[model samples]
Target chain A: MEIIELINVKREFKILNRREGIAGGIKDLFSRDYRYLSAVDDISLKIKKGEIVGYLGPNGAGKSTTIKMMTGILEPTSGKVLVNGKEPYRNRIENAQDIGVVFGQRSQLWWSLPLKESFKVLKEIYQVSDKDYKDMLDLYMSLIDIKNLWDKPVRQMSLGQRTLSDILAAFLHNPSVVYLDEPTIGLDVSMKSKIQEFIKGLNSQKATTIILTTHDMGDVDALCNRIVIIDKGKKLYDDNIENLHKMFGMYRIMKICFSKDVGELDYDSLKDKAAELEKELQENFSGDDMTVSVDEGWIDILMNEEDVSLMEVMNFIQSKQHIYNIKLEEISTEKVIKKIYEGGTIL
Target chain B: MKKRNVKFYLAIYFKIISQDIKSKLSYRVDFIISTMGILFTNIAGFITFWIIFKNFDNINDWNYYEILFLYGFSLMALTPTQCLFDNNWNLRDYVYSGDFIKYCFRPIDLYFYYISEIFDLKGIGEFMMGVGIIVYAWINLKYSVTILGILALIVMWIAASLVMAGIMNIAAATCFWMNNSGYVMVTVFKFTEYTKYPIDIFNKGFRIFFSFIIPIAFVTYYPSMVVLNSHNLPILTIIAPIFSVLFFYISYRIWMFGASRYNGTGT
Candidate 1:
């Protein structure tokens, strides 16, 4: 079942054009000049039930706007937005009952109250049954160690703890669809993994459909099976991680560390040596698509694995220098996304 | 959407208010000091009235005790909104900071949820002071009260509170379009001062402006006249309650319109 759908949805904001100087400010009072900026432009999507989808985008790419429309906090300017078969903006209260939202920069929890107090207020607001509330609490407690943080005031808790508590509060009512915007932002590795595990556990246990908007690729890797990428108010790519990798996964990075330090060479001499090495490698592998550069004491090679195998590059580098260590890395999702943003791949 | 009964909202209101009070009381000294500050400020106003009454025989045929009664009644009427709807004053900040989106994300009525987030404990001090002045004036005037009179007073008080709340909500809703509605709210709230005195003392223009345009005169001036039996127009007293309800209904509609136009700040 499709739990969320958007057909050619668009949103535009009227931005005031403020002139310079005091005299210009006075003129602004008399004249209303505005420029319309489209935030979400003619995007269509369908999200199925029990699926965790990563909504990824660059800055100002309309990711937040799309999430806002889905959560019922914003209305699309031109098209239809439906969550659970109801227009979210028109049936906001009903839609809100089944949807939960978490904004990393903005918190919905009561700052001065203890964590549990905020949860109790949410319990009353959502009208969660006592049995259901208790059962949810038990399930969460078993999955994570949050019992100690329950009595701490939200103001005193760290950012990660507060975000954790917020996620718990949002899911306390067992909302069928949850939207997490940058849930892992600014969190340390351990906290991030803990939250990822908790989200994974809840999603499996309840079969809740989750729409996660995040800049962190680790979050996408750990929690999402399908990913949607958007840029500049337009959808660029939408597919599973495996498909995305298969399309752009041929690139690889090979780092070869020299046994001798290259710091003895001057900056100009270092550039000269890197150029010489690049020319030599290109001459040797003429038809291969590759780029070579030299760091402090390491020679780095980025090449398409399909054109030139890792063994060929390693053998060539080994013959040129007394190698101390060699490291091979697959293309990271971050790099693939950066490449997509740079318009290197055709969608 | 499922239609929820009033009982559900009432239960949620009490829960939210109780939590608000609990958090407020955590800072015990701040609560005590602010409450005392409000009490002192109201007492200072009463003292100003006392000084004026000492010099004049009567202001517009109303004696000192009657004016005091009117002042107390105004304060009492203002207290309900003052206690509950204080969050309206921060609507500008909430909208600018994008915090208002949280209310829209909730399953409850936006206005009810917004107001329930805070319960001004300092208004308790204002309530006590108003009641104290009313009791003192009642004893001096030798006013014999009956059950019907008490019921009428309650109705008038509730109607007056609705007028104040309606005005405040309307003013605060302007923040959706403007950069800030703080100045607008303060200017409109200043009109309530005219209710503390006899509306007859004002010129025809001011009287009509307050009565018809803003309807602030109905908040306390005209309602108190009915209670004191000194009203020249009996019809004004009867329509005051109905007019207040109509004003509040219109204000609620305006609020809904403003809310629909709300485009939140950038993330």
Candidate 2:
């Protein structure tokens, strides 16, 4: 069943046009100017129960705005936002009862209180049953070693610890839907994997529907079954990860390090050499399915594996210059997203 | 979220407040210093009153003790908002830092959650000082206390507190549009200084403005008049309770409107 649905939702903001310098500042007081910006522009979405969807977007691409509208912190400029079949903004309190939200840049936990105290307050606020609260504590304690953090004030806890506690608090009420905006941001790799494991465990145990907005592709790969990519307030692609891979995964990266030290050349000379090599390769290949660039003394080539094999590209480069090292890489979600941002076709 | 009753809300409020106090008390030195600071500041104001009244017989026929009664009444009226609603001062920071979104995420009233997040314990010192001054002034004036009169005073005190809190809510709500309403809140709150004196000292126009327009006069001056039984318009005392309730309701509506217009800071 659909637990969260957004229909043509849009949010516009009126930003003041602050002028430059002291003189311009003085002039602004007399005649104020504002420009309207559509942060979320007519985006439609449907999220089902127990679905973990990665809401992916580049910076300033309205990912956070869409999450805000879903969480009822923002009322869309037009169109509908329904959570559990109720308009979220109009019925925020009721909607809030059924959902939880965590913004990575902003903490929801009480800064001065301990993790356990904050949990107790949340328990009262959500009216969690005593049995449910105890079960939640037991579940969390069994999954993770969090006893040491129970009495530590949130201000004293490290970033990863605080984030872990925040996630725990968010799921404590067992809300049917949860929104995690950049929850894994700034954590170390091990902590990131641990959090991912915890999230997976909770998802399987409770079947909680999760909408995760993030820049980290690792999180997307580990937690999300479906991915929705957006750009500049427009929906670019929304599909299961496998389908996305099948469509964009044919591309491969070839990194070739030449025995000649390209670092000895100036940046301009290096750019000129890269451009010359790219032109020669394009003329030889006679196809637009490949891109070549120079990075840190290595000539990196990204091309569709179907159009040209890795062995062909490596052999051509090796014949021209003595090869020091060579590496091949399959396309990842990260590279695919970069390609999409570079205006690649969705299909 | 559900159809919660008043008792449920009150219980949750105490729960949150107790946790807030526990966190605040953790910083022992800071807590003591702030409480002492508030106590000293109020004592300094009382000393100024003492120095002024020592030279003059009275200001506009109001004696020193009478003025003390009014001052004490004003402080008592201000205490509830100071202790319970002091978190309104942090609204600007919350909005600017994008922390206000946390309040919206909770399954509770936004205003209730915001206010419950902090309880300024220093207001306890202010309350004790206010009560001490009121008792001292009452003894000096030899005012007889009756059960009915005490009940009336309690009602007026609650009304006065609502008036102060309503004004504060209106000032804080401007943060939604302005992004920072510190100056507005401070300037509006400074007007509370007028409540510590008799409205008769001001000109007729200023007196009318304070009583009707800004309503600070209703907070302490008019209420004190009713207590002292020297009120020319006893009807104002009756209207004070209703006016305070309506004033708070309107202010809450303004806050809700501002909250709806809240465009959170950039991600």
lDDT of 2: 0.85
TM-score of each: 0.88, 0.91
Interface RMSD of each: 2.2, 2.0
Candidate with top DockQ is: 2
Encode model 1's per-residue lDDT on B24-132: one tens digit a residue: 8988999999999998998898889899999997999999999999999999989988999999998889888877877778898888877777788889888888888
Residue A45 in model 2: lDDT: 94
Collision pairs in model 2: none
| Candidate 1 structure quality by residue, lDDT tens digits, A175-238 | 9999998988899999999999999999999989999998899999999999999987888888
The fraction of correct interface contacts reproduced by each prediction comes to 0.62, 0.70
**What DockQ, on C-alphas, does every prediction get?**
0.46, 0.55
Instruction: Point out where model 2 deviates above 4 Å.
Output: A11-37, A258-299, A306-309, B230-233
**Cα-based lDDT for every prediction:** 0.85, 0.85
Predicted complex 2: CAPRI docking category: medium
Error of 1 at A151 (Å): 3.3
